[model samples]
Target: MEGRAFTHTRRALWETRTTFETAPYGSIAAAYFAMWLGLRGIKLSAVILHDLATALGAKAVARATQYFLQSLRPEVGSQPVHGWDSLIFLIIYSVIVFLPLWWLADLRWARGAVYRYRATTRTTKALHFCAEAYSRPPGKRTSQLRDLESGLRAAENAILRAHRYAGTFPRRSPRSAAVRAHAALVAGALRAESLKIDADPNATLPRLGAMLAVIGERCAEGRIGAMLSEEFLAEATPVSLTRTAIRESVHVIVVVTAAMVAAVGGSSALRALGVNDDLRPWLIAGCSVVAAIVVGGWHRVGRLLELMPGK
Candidate 1:
């Protein structure tokens, strides 16, 4: 009896399932997130490297200028060079660290949507094939059950391909709803057809044929494609464009700010500690690690909040 109950439950789930198949979103996100965090580390390292290189370069330039000045005027040799000369260099290094990393993050973020579109294309293709396959004569369809089921499975696979990624995005959308509805329609009809075949291996299911006819009519209407197209195009609207621009600008600002703070602040903190010049480079490296931790932790905290139950 227990076995029978389990079988019935399984059958019910198979027949009624409407949600997109689950993908490895959590695993993929975790992996990609590690890489994202590594980019922060790289940014920190860039700042450290920039400071060291500029220190050495500035020293050489200062020595050359000092010698040239002393040769021209013996008393001018003792004049001090402004320490803030490297400020502009630090800003330049910040831009160097910002652009490529920012581009990579944007690419990773956009990848989720790219996969979604691919999944939609595959599912739509499968749906169209199923509709065509169902249009066959009843006798021919008996020999085509395997093919029809294969098509349905393909559609399910396609939707699942990006399911996990889609979950990270906002829930409500016309395109997603339409796709879910179409999948449910197809899944229900196919499950019913299979049950009929199981009950009578050789008989044609008039009920299933009528259901398939309706499904074909629905597919013919092309409502799913229309809805998806509408939603996709809506992303290009002025408001959406402005929102995207603002979000991108925020990312750039955050990254550049972190880089500058880590570089300049690290040097100042070392100076305040009265560390000897020989230890300053080593201390700066240590400070970079600390800065990476603080900045990366802050970013990850925001991400965790975003992934929380609501907003």
Candidate 2:
């Protein structure tokens, strides 16, 4: 019976550890909210310019390539001849259709990243304060420690259950990376507190002070602390990791939207140009190539940025 009890206790601790390791959903929500506010702060002219450039570039390249291919093809039969003017018209129509959708999607993603970052920062601060308080001299310190542990356990379980739900739903994409980072910081702080508890579960004042000092120092210098500081300082300026994340998300949306517009517009242009049926495969292939280039380039750039220090 004792062995079974020990096993159950160990399992509970492990669950608590896992929960503490994950970043809280509240942090993620707040970070995204901040990003949304940042997006609103951007200049309207700049946003319009960005959209125009993307649309123009995509249309120009796609139309030019389509025309060049059409010139090489033999006139097999008298079908519909979609001239350059028709192709241009289709491109313009497609751009107008897709740009708004892309912009909104980008905005959503940017907001999410910001929310996660801010939330993590706040949670870390709270956890650090609690850890320090729990480490004070005995008497009140002991009571505080018990209360903190109890609170942490409850929070951890709730977070774990939320994480499980997040994992189960594709639409519920929780900011796992940020969550894990915060969780690590909390666990480290808790571990330091546990050391004090084991040294003198009776909660001696001197031991509590020493433990608090040591844990406080660790919390201040550890990964979580560093991340929090980085975010806080970054938010002070426009050119921070958070900004970069927003920009990258915007770029991706623009690129993907351009590709889709080009593909659809190119198809419509082909239909209008009276191009032969044999040319359909070539047109489809060309559209695929454009999409691949945009998507592949976006992926490479995002990966490179992620690999960069502080990103």
Candidate 3:
């Protein structure tokens, strides 16, 4: 039962990857474009509101900003805009409106959609391959299975290392370090498994199980275990882990892009409305802080996703 389950899971993962790789560029492009459009809409709306508040009535602008700041409690420091006075109303209003839209479009909706799509596609392919491999006579396929298991283990180890090192190094460090580590590990594991299969066409299920146990034990001792529970490790196949990691990478990209777009739009909208000239410095500072938080949070989420079962 365990062998059958593992094979099924791997085949599913391979199928999922194949689907993603084959997807029309236009479809993916459209999804990303929609995210941008949503962000732009929010920015435009905020700008219009800011202009209306400023030109139509200063008191109205002040009241609106106050309400927004009070409600949102943005980390605006002790500046003129942060005060009860209406001077920075337009800026505050823009931020209040745009921040939520950005969050909704990028972090919540778009990210979820992307993650689910990738996960489904990758898992499908992996499981298909696993099933095919397992269907072969045990004596004929033992070596191949062993090699595959080893490759998978190596890849898993690399991914764990990348996760651990994330945010630990300086800002200027190459982004590919983590990615490379993961890739190397995956390649090594796959290579080992392939070799084993070539050497021995007929391998037993017990040997395969032992190989899995070895990898699982090593992974559990590493930082990778912190993110993935023993239950997940025991049940998950190599294909699933790889697929999950890829899906998570997509989410990170979407979320980070959305946050950046929001920051720029929010800043621009605030400036256009001329809501808080006196509190300009503080407002900028506050926005910077918020942007940092968003980016940091997005990174953490990506890491967590990578650690999850069933990529």
Candidate 4:
């Protein structure tokens, strides 16, 4: 009966640890809500919907390419193209249309709002666990010690993840540097506490707990994640509604206009080269594929700039 009880206790502790480790994902919804609330008063621009614009631009480019190809081979235009050829074109189009959006979304800053909130929540919770452990008597501290250790580890992971996006162009801010140093301190302290606990299961972590309390206090005071306050509001660039509308209108017009011009120029270039009518369709397809790749790469590069942390 004693052995079974020990097994159950260990299993419970393991489950708690697992919960702490996966806590960041659950924190995402809260973070998103915090971010939305922060930006609620401000009018968001279509810039946030850049992925949609890129998709529309890709479609326009594809349509223009197709129109030009058909014009080049009026004789063969009547013949049904092979299924394989259409499928290949579609694959190329999809890559051009979706790859950039995926790349942009994958970047760390794309989720900065959530990461910031998670980091703050983790740090605060770690401090709470530490305080609880510190106040408890040594004889009754095993569970609290385990929870404190788990919380500290979770906080460290969250802080490091937030640290990744806490930089501006070319360099990180002083606040970010401090946060990173704090994360390193947490790592060292957690390790020391873990070693002490391994030596004696009932060991107290007063020093580690005290240190983490200071860090959490700083976080609450706007050192890291700004405690999800007005700092989040500052993250969004303030642009007039008129300017935003004009910017979006210009973006749509430019993308579509560029697509049409490129198609016309490409068709004229192929004609000047005296390319055979029989081969023009394949050549146009190849060129469209190349253009799609270049455009996708360009979009990815543009989105990568978002990785730079906002002030």
Candidate 5:
């Protein structure tokens, strides 16, 4: 729809610099608005709402967490400088300190959010429409029903082929391959159900319609079920868990090392900024503990890693 467009929220360096420094609110507002508008149609609103809720929940947790962390730090240098000067420092400090923690929390929730979003997009509206056609009077729907039935068989064969090929990826990308296998199984079941329908003499629309409705419902559910396939979960679980564990351990180590070093240098650093550091121990411990907690929430953080591309 355009020759040159900037759909991405982040672009040029100057724009990013200005946005982050002067009004991060603009960035936040743009992101929120874009999410709503981008997903306004095509039936993904539920996914968006879920993500919003997850983010809100993460924010609430991050707020409490940051408050507790602040309490653990020295109050000596925290006295206000007053006016906009103080605000600038506070903004910088908040970005430097709390944002990363909140971002990690958000990343945790974004995993489920992405999976739900992708699953929601794979709808069965076309199948429902075909169901309606199949429900019509026999004389009127013969040709359409025949074509639809043939199409279903073709789709089933294609999906079965895909399922067979999935084994090749079981060791490489088991999660996605498992989804295909699950979807293929469900599709196969639906095909068998359709094949079971009696085309007896003078069969009524009521019987045909019921079977079609069943097919339609199954069509809708199969895709979502694939997204949550047990086999896929089973095959992918160990890999994801291992990666998540290693990542979390590294994060904890980094946090502990960084905090301890910072606490050591904190006195000089604070003095340079005309402040003091009396709660070095508290700061070091709090930072280490908070970082560990952020990584240790396996259910939240682990799934987030699983959702990542090429994970």
Candidate 6:
């Protein structure tokens, strides 16, 4: 058992080392480092541009050597290509290209991810409906009173469920906050309507109705995802945002320019000193990781300028 365990561990280590040696580890490490720095508000644009330029160059080189790039020439395939061959082709094409692009661009895939982690679609719809209901919503006053009543009832049920599962949420959980807010709003609206009815038995209620409509509009159009609402977590860029961007842009330019020069000059110098091909890629990768860490950590010091507040 001990011998088998030792052999398995050694084999795993050897495989890992071999993969690193053959793969584009230098470019990968540099790319990740660039992303970390960018996210931390280091001159993000410059770092990104550098990575983009590198990718373009790499792609150009790759094209010369590789064949069968996801699909054939469009002009060559004028005839309708159908059956099992087309199905297999589409599966391979999607796996190689479409899936990565979808994830990177955060298309419909993000919505699924949002639902999986936070509140369900049913809960979100209930919150929105309740918010709109409380405001009475324009063109939907007494005409949709039944819908308003049903929405509020659904929201109340959702809030009760949320409270019951309070342990499932995070400290600053948006879904929980939204649920609580809607529950309070429902109670408040009911109380306000009751008081208005008691004070004036035959009140026309034009002002009260208008106010609710406006509030409902805000709630309906204010959110990006289930939890990120304008009222809850503001997405508007701050006044100081321009200044912060300029500073970071300058940082990126300086860092990226220096990195390019060093990479070119140092590589040639190291080659002259007889650095073997086997060791050179690892050295480059190490440098890329170090560069990313330093810039990322530098901005993480002192006060983190809230580039996008509450993001």
Per-prediction backbone clash count:
0, 20, 48, 0, 0, 2
**Best candidate (score: TM-score):** 4
**What are the per-residue Cα lDDT tens digits for candidate 5 across 1-311?**
11123122112212324434334455446554654464344134434544564578754334333433343357825743432233333454454444433443233322222122221212122244356555676567666666556555444433333323223234455566555555555454545445444454134333333433333333223332342234323423122323444875686566556555655565455456654343443444455444444544433344334443324
lDDT of each: 0.45, 0.43, 0.45, 0.49, 0.41, 0.39
User: Between the candidate structures 3 and 6, which one is better when assessed by TM-score?
Assistant: 6
Model 3: how far residue 307 lies from native, Å: 16
Q: Please identify model 3 stretches exceeding 4 Å from their true place.
A: 1-190, 204-209, 221-311
5 or 6, which is superior by TM-score?
A: 6
What would the per-residue lDDT of candidate 6 be over residues 155-226, giving only the tens digit for each residue?
Answer: 333322333222445557776555555434433443344345225423424333332333223222222122
Lowest-sum lDDT 10-residue window in model 6: 109-118
Clashing pairs in 5: none
lDDT of 3 by residue, 21-88 (tens): 33435545665577567655555554566677777776656455445444343455543333334435
Give the worst 10-residue stretch by lDDT in candidate 5.
1-10
For all predicted structures, in order, the TM-scores are: 0.24, 0.22, 0.25, 0.31, 0.25, 0.28
- Find the candidate with the highest lDDT and give its number: 4
Per-residue CA lDDT of model 4 for 212-300, tens digit only, reads 44444444333554322232233333223344348645654554455455566767888899987656656665565455445444343
After superposition, which runs of candidate 4 have C-alpha atoms over 4 Å from their true positions?
1-114, 165-182, 197-204, 220-311
Better of 4 and 5 by lDDT: 4
Tell me the deviation in Å of residue 194 in model 3.
2.2
lDDT computed for candidate 2: 0.43
Candidate 2 lDDT tens digits, 1-311? 11223343233224334533233456445655765564454335334544665577865445434443343346523324354434553444444344443333233343322222232322333354456654565556655665555444333332222223223234334555554444444444434444556466555323333333332232222323232223223322222234444875787676667667777887788888887765664675578556746665644445444443234
